[model samples]
Target: MQTIANTTSDFIRVSSEIGTLRRLLIHSPDRGLGKVVPSKAQDWLFEDIVNLDMMRRDEYDFYVKLLLYFLDPDKIKGRVANLAPGTDRGFFKPDHPDYFASEKVIDIQCLLSDILADEVIRTKLIAAICGIERTSFKTQQQLTSVDPVELAKILISGSLPDRTMLFAPLPNFIFTRDIGIVINDHILLNKPAKQARTREALLAQYIFFNHSLFADYRDKIIEIPDNEHAFLLPDSDTARDLSRSTLEGGDVMMIGPRHLLIGCSERTTLYAAQQVMRLVFDKGVVDTVTIIKIPKKRDYMHIDTVFTQVKRNVWVLLGTLARTGDEARKQDVMHFFAPKDLSEDLKILQFRKGQEQKPIEIENLEDLLANISRNDLGATEPVTFIYSGNNEFPFGAREQWTDSCNLLALKDGVVVGYDRNDYTAEAFRQAGFDVVTAAEVLDRFERGESSPEAIENTFIMLPSAELSRARGGSHCMSLPLLREGF
Candidate 1:
């Protein structure tokens, strides 16, 4: 239980969801959106056709604004107040000052700038891109001569002049949580389920490996060897065979210090989960690994989209999974809803350094969770569950589809989510959380009207008119590197 202050390295460490966020990794929806056409939207993993301009202006702009505000409230507030009068501040606190501060918001581009500042890293990146593109020597020379910043943009956004689609637009790269998860003191780079997102994993790996921010824990990074091989040698037979083991960050949840819950959902495979457990055990990262087998459906793609911990004891969960209905009991699609027969669905693996792996069965998710809290957390408090749509059918289905369950906790009892899910918002309100808009929270903080500490059970809602269409919530869009200890 090391606190963020006591922790020696700044690379990676996350124990619980409801800890104060310290650092994050996010990607802006830029060139990725440019590559997504209507005919190839489904293949590119987009739910519906999207206008690139709208995504950039309406969705990504606000998303970045909200994140920057959370990361540095005072700086962002001051910057916004200084902006020109007619400028669309988006969700910033309205009209306090009209000055312009030229500081750029921290995003993937900023991180890439930092990474490319190093000559060694810049050279390696250029060579890698050239190798991937199979470009000619003259083209490689031209890329080497170009400025690092422009080269980074080319690497991420792609280059039409060179006719090299080195890294195709990573449309889904906006969901940073799907690329990596921090556990204990290390980073576990995820292997995405689709080829469209493979470049994102490479980009993350390059950052953790080359960027000075993560230099302290370069060796501490953990990733499936199969994924590494696939990224480096996509055409190799070895890489192809090893690619069968797949795991995405969206499926992983670090519930406690030594308790990790991973879901075998549409994106993660059972073999991948087993492999991850072996690596964690070898590294002495956790004592137990609980695999929650969720339904393999588009709507239920990841566990976080269906279940998320909002408070110490309270969880916002999909209503349908919490209880068995007459229709479910009568049918036998996956038997995942058999509340009485938990052993059939839940799987727990116990591991130690030199011992063989042991499997344990449980009756249901509740019992499994209760045991985890008791054994791992050493707490006897009863766990509480809040339904997404208050046990309503179509409403619950609708809200879940819009990622009502996928809330990102800034700290205990403080979370950020989309405001479109009214039913879910009401549920949180009834649970003692004040549903405040991002603008309201920022305005109050800037005016010295209130501090985050002064607020209790607050649910900050982000404007997600276009973001919601991307089919990811706040949690999906962020990769938290550091969070204050709970």
Candidate 2:
């Protein structure tokens, strides 16, 4: 557990999604999760109340340990024999005295604390957060007196050390991928659509702008201007609000050095997508930008949830949205009688910097994925698709609900995903990828029987009973700050 004084500026590039991961951001589940009561769960964007203890100790603990092994091995390599994680609280908790504070396997809470150590930043942040929470002047004064580490915890969990509630909990902080994304070397911060996520974006903005770890690239940060009255409008029931420019990191992907993908889904609107596309093009960051528009349903909130890269030529996605018009409609006899459900259809349009009017419309999801691999990546192998739940009846929708398609690729063809999605795991196996449990892999690494370098084209399964309740997968949980370019 080492603290980061500064991460080299050159270590902040992410030109491809499936490149080897060297550094990233993640958050450990906090006590705020335990406070989500059924009455306020929907308002807070949580599907259901989760057992906080189980989610932390049994499920998320594995994710932390697994990441430590892959990115910062020395921190936990020899500690496996002595660390009784079940009984130890300090090892994983960022606020605890015995926490493993690795620089490479960075935690957002730690970065928050680091910046708060400065009196100027601490005062400014207190005012900003207090304004958003609408806290009383007395409460803001009291917060100014708290320690940086404690204050970071309180700001995120919305609880004091005495278990007193101060404001609404930022439960979605665990989904770090929604805050901001690094494209090439520039950082495009997120503008959240839902009021529930407003604080998350605010905190991220402060950290990226003020933190010395990212000081070298501060001038390159891009922000979208919201609608003049967007703040006053109550959460919209419809998905694409053109007047407002709302964007999340989950909708933005750095597919290749010369290409970027932005989704016009529930969280991101076409206005924001166009704004970002023009910004990147003017900056000469990338030459191609593709926007994939899907239904605004809560089930498919972002493009990453529908599909993510497994390898240069491999993709796992939901078949319902990837199929052609004829394939999407089942039973030709009944097709004539039933009106097509326009809501389930997917639309993809690609734009080049100088040729905006001649945008090319892609027919299906598979075609867009294959083009990225063959043309953008120059892959010699044939492109392949592994459908969610093996593209079977009932399973495709059922497993997608549990995040079978949302996976984080540790490296090309090596990924981390939930083990609960049995059908998706079988699909990975059929695609010639070996599926193994994270616990077993950890044991093997500890005993020196296997290593991260030796693993390839494999699915490292993680425990997901309680994590699934959050309705996000590893892809949503991670913010890759640095990755090797293919």
Candidate 3:
């Protein structure tokens, strides 16, 4: 472990050293269940309130086995119990003032205390926490009459009257990669916008700053003076409610130290993305931050929903939205956010003398399918796009909701995808990739199987009903610390 004293050093610029990936951080499932329930699971940021014990144990097995596979003990780490040292603190606790004030009061602190102090309360707490009610059927008028904070308090108390409340559940903790953005050897522990995810951020802050596995690099944290909320708003409304513009790490991706591809979706705002870019640019953290707007649809909610890079310039593009007829003529609406010519494409084609006029075009699904086969010629690498649906039917609208395009890149050519996507697997196999089944992975999770394993070169495909409902895939669930050539 190496520790440097320059606190202002930037850690976002380095091209990832793929083979030397010894230190990667993760968060196993924890007290996030109390925040999710059948009735309010949708609003709580979860698709369902699962069994906490099962989820945690499964997550433990996943992270543990992954670490074992890597064979680098110090390289793989989890921050579930690491957030609050010597204390079994959950994300939500009733004792915290926020619990009483907010309708989603999970009381992570008090709940953790009870979990540690009494086994009986822990069981009851888990039940109440995961037994929350849903408001999906409530009319707008009916919902408006109840204060959100008051409703949250009532729900927590009603569900689990015996346990103390602490904090709201941290649903985003599973995707640890997005919580902090790395710049060179430094990491900026972002002050997240959502209160629910604040504890997750705090836990991450603790891991990077205090834990022996990663604490040596504390001085590398980006510390802006007198700007606690510097990472939140762009010097605009400092007093505004933080939750209104809530952002998460899953919605952002670092293409390189200088260049980035961020998903501006329902969870992350366009202004928020711009504000983040401006903040980092001012510090010379990055040169370009490409704002890839996610189409406003449940299925196409994130950038990773449609496009994902496999090797260098080679990408597995899911051709879902095809523009034809009148919609195609209005250039702005059709091609505004379309993946016409990405920066990666520009840099890879060594066009000299400002000859950057090469435009990558794919008309319909057939055109895109044809270009991929022809584009990588002379290049030994196998390249192809696995069409999510059959070519016979024009599944323009249906593809988006079905996540026909979202595939997790394992190595340069290898990938892990949904088993339900038999067509996608066949396409990849045709493209010369060893497409693996997610059934074994899901079965391993259900069986409480545990062993050390490395997460490198391994794309774990989790159950994505809730996540897919938000329009993202395993690629959205993961943040890469290493790339092949980098």
Instruction: Say which candidate scores most in lDDT.
Output: 2
All predictions: root-mean-square deviation over Cα? 5.9, 2.9, 12.7
TM-score for each model: 0.82, 0.94, 0.54
Tens digits of per-residue lDDT for model 3 on 360-465? 3333433432333343222344444444443213342344344555544444343444444545545556655544434344334334463223222333433333
lDDT of 1 by residue, 1-486 (tens): 000121344546788777777667666665556666678778778887666666665445555655566665555665444222224565321111321111223355556666776788888877876676577777777777766556666777666434456445667877889888999788898988777676677777787777666767778898885554545555564334445677898899887887788888788887788789889988988877778887667888998998887777677877666543435432332343343432243344444444544466554565665565556555556766666775455676688888899998877778888888888889887877799877677677668787766776888887676778788998998888777764
lDDT to native, each model: 0.70, 0.86, 0.42
Model 2, range 1-486, lDDT digits (tens) per residue? 234667475868999999999899999898888878899998889999998887887778778888888899998886665334355422468866667778878889998998899999999999999998999999999999998888999999999989899998989999999999999999999998889999999899999998888888898898887667666666662333847899998899999999999999888999899989989999999999999999887988999998999998999998778763445444331354225543246899999989978999998888899999999888889999998888766677778889998999988998989988999999999999999988788888999998889888999888888999999999999999889888
- Alpha-carbon deviation at 385 in model 2, angstroms: 0.5
- Stretches of candidate 3 exceeding 4 Å from the true structure: 1-22, 51-67, 70-165, 191-195, 206-246, 321-383, 387-410, 438-473, 479-485
Clashing pairs in 2: none
- Put the candidates in TM-score order, highest first: 2, 1, 3
Q: What shift in Å separates residue 79 of candidate 3 from its native position after superposition?
A: 23
